[model samples]
Target: MKKLLIILLVLTGTTAIKAQTRTADESAIEKTWARFGNSWRNQNFSDMKDYMTPDCHWINVVGMHWRNLKEVQFAHQAFITAFLKDAKAVDKSSNLRFLTNDVAIMYRVTHIGAFYPPDGIDHGTNKQGDKDNIATIVFVRQNGKWLIASGHNSDVVAQAAASDPVLHMNK
Candidate 1:
């Protein structure tokens, strides 16, 4: 009985140590996501690529297609032309969950710098929009670096507002 108790105590201690290690890894993912968002707002796509896998996949809600890194960067040029005119991503929040020591998923909400018209018209040359979206990103850490494996963003404001009629009416 004493031997069994000793074995159980060792196992519990090991488990506690492992859990602490995993929490540290999960916390790093938050900083990784922050770097990604900042680089994007700065139009530093090249710098941003370090956060993404070479074959990273982007699922854009725009219904264009599932784009690879290069295509996404090219598309961003257009995005920059429209949104980056005087806009930025602000009020960001990142929530991360670890699938493993090397794999993580993040849910984030952030404001885009300007309001985009549905017809692809650029408005508010210097002014901004109240538009923001929520996104999900999958990150994989390989060879001591974290790379984005997949990501998707969806419009959340209108849907969230619609759910609360009083808030919508106030707006």
Candidate 2:
């Protein structure tokens, strides 16, 4: 019985240690995300270019597709200048899944705050007054640094019908 007890303790300790540890890749990815968030808040798309691959693809919340890094930088700069100059991006939560040692996908929920329409334009807001979007970004490690390869952002909408049993069980 004493031997069994010792084995169980050892197993538990191993599990706890593993749970508390994060790989270097995970730490690097987290830092990359922090830098991206900072760039967005600063409205510095030029700095953001360094984080993305030259052939990066991005799809915005409104369904506009940017096919390359140049397009992505240009569109973000224009949009921020015209409408979202004062908007701030707050990352609510994120989950990263690795497909390979060099490739990972991150799903992030971000809140856009301090939003206001430009010059008498009325872009209606939700009841919460702020907007939340979910972004799925693919990151690929190139030359020891992770770079954004592709991404898609979609507005998070609360729909009661989506939770209905009939719709959920359709699959």
Deviation (Å) of 41 in candidate 2: 1.2
Instruction: State every prediction's TM-score relative to the real structure.
Output: 0.75, 0.75
Off by over 4 Å in 2: 1-22, 114-129, 160-171
Model 1 per-residue lDDT tens digits across residues 1-171 = 999999999999999999898777776676777777676667666665767777787776565655678886676656665555456777577788888778888888887755454434565453445677788899998888777888888766665676876865755
lDDT of each: 0.73, 0.80
- Quote model 1's TM-score: 0.75
In model 2, how many backbone clashes occur?
0
The candidate that wins on TM-score is 2
Tens digits of per-residue lDDT for model 2, 26-105: 88888887877777777778887678899999998779999999998898878777567767788899999989879999
Deviation (Å) of 169 in candidate 1:
24
Candidate 1 segments exceeding 4 Å error: 116-129, 159-171
